[model samples]
Target: MKINEYNVVAIEYSLKDANTNEQLDTNVGGKPLEFITGMGQIIKGLEAEILKMTVGDKADVMVAPADGYGEYNDQAVQVLPKEQFAGIDLVQGMTLYGTSEEGDTVQVTVTNFDDNEVTIDYNHPMAGKTLMFTVSILDAREATDQEMATGVVGGVASGGCCGGGSCGSSGGHSHGHSHGEGECCGGENHKHGGQGHGGCGCH
Candidate 1:
């Protein structure tokens, strides 16, 4: 079937940086990543590309900085008082979590530190990098009514709630579902069909 909104898609992908030719992510020895189209479960550029493909198709796409994570912003860098990190040992390249001015917890990397100042950068790690996606569509199918209703494709039985205070199997992985406002793989909650914040580099 043609890939469209609400269709569950399974894909194998190799993500690279266009400029450095460095591989950033890949599906190696792991299950194919699955998600529903136009569901904001995936990045905008990659999702848009998937919509143009059919099951069993493959394509290599180059996503520009603007279409991907956007250009790096210098304003994202800030110097915090050294005392703010009371018990943590500060070091370059260390990732630290703290609340932002807006009250959202954000992940910032320690770029530098001195006796009284700590340089922290909130810019996304790949903010300025062009993303090159080598994508292979493994499978595609129409989602069930229940899957569409809960915004999750696989895992729970029909009429079962897997998220949002609903209880189900905790060990099984649910493919193509929104994480809502819970932590997944130690990362922040990701809303289905919405733009991701700066932490997980998937943005």
Candidate 2:
């Protein structure tokens, strides 16, 4: 069937930095990445291209930074007292997780630090770079009523792709979750995966 809004689709893809040609993430020989269409589960640019394909189709899709993770903002950088991250061995260029004032889980990178202060960048690690996703659609089907209601491929608690971290394994987004590196898929309650390449994951 033609892929449509709210359809659950599974894809196997390899993501790369379009300019540098650096492979950022892939699920080639791994589990298929799956999500519901028009639900904001993956980057819009990639999704737009995916909607044009059918099961067993393959394509190379390009996603501008704005449509993916967004452009990097200098204002997103902030210097906080070192005490804010006490006890952890801070490493420059490493991603870290923290809670925002609204209690939302946020991810930041250690850009610079010293004995008294730490400079963190709130921009996603992949921000500002265009991305290329070489994708193969494995499956696509209309979502059931329960799936649509829960915004998951399956009904709530039925353990959709996000629950297994397949869709978000380095790239995809829904809400309250960043797919860069090892960020969790399901939001505040899920455990972050091991740090991988910088990219978005379905979360």
Ten residues in sequence with the least summed lDDT for candidate 1: 161-170
Candidate 2 lDDT, 71-189, residue by residue in tens = 77777777777876655676676666555544445566678999998887766667787888888899999988887777655543332232223333222223344343222322322
For model 2, the run of ten residues with the poorest summed lDDT: 194-203
- The most accurate candidate by lDDT is 2
Native-referenced Cα lDDT, model 2: 0.63
The pairs that clash in candidate 2 are 168-202, 170-200, 171-200, 171-201, 171-202, 172-200, 172-201, 172-202, 179-201
**Clash tally, candidates in order:** 2, 9
lDDT tens per residue, model 1, 1-203: 67999887888778788899987767645666666665555656777888999888999988886666557777777776788666666657665553343444454567888999878766655667788888888899987887677666674423221111111111232222333311221122222112322332101
Error of 1 at 1 (Å): 2.3
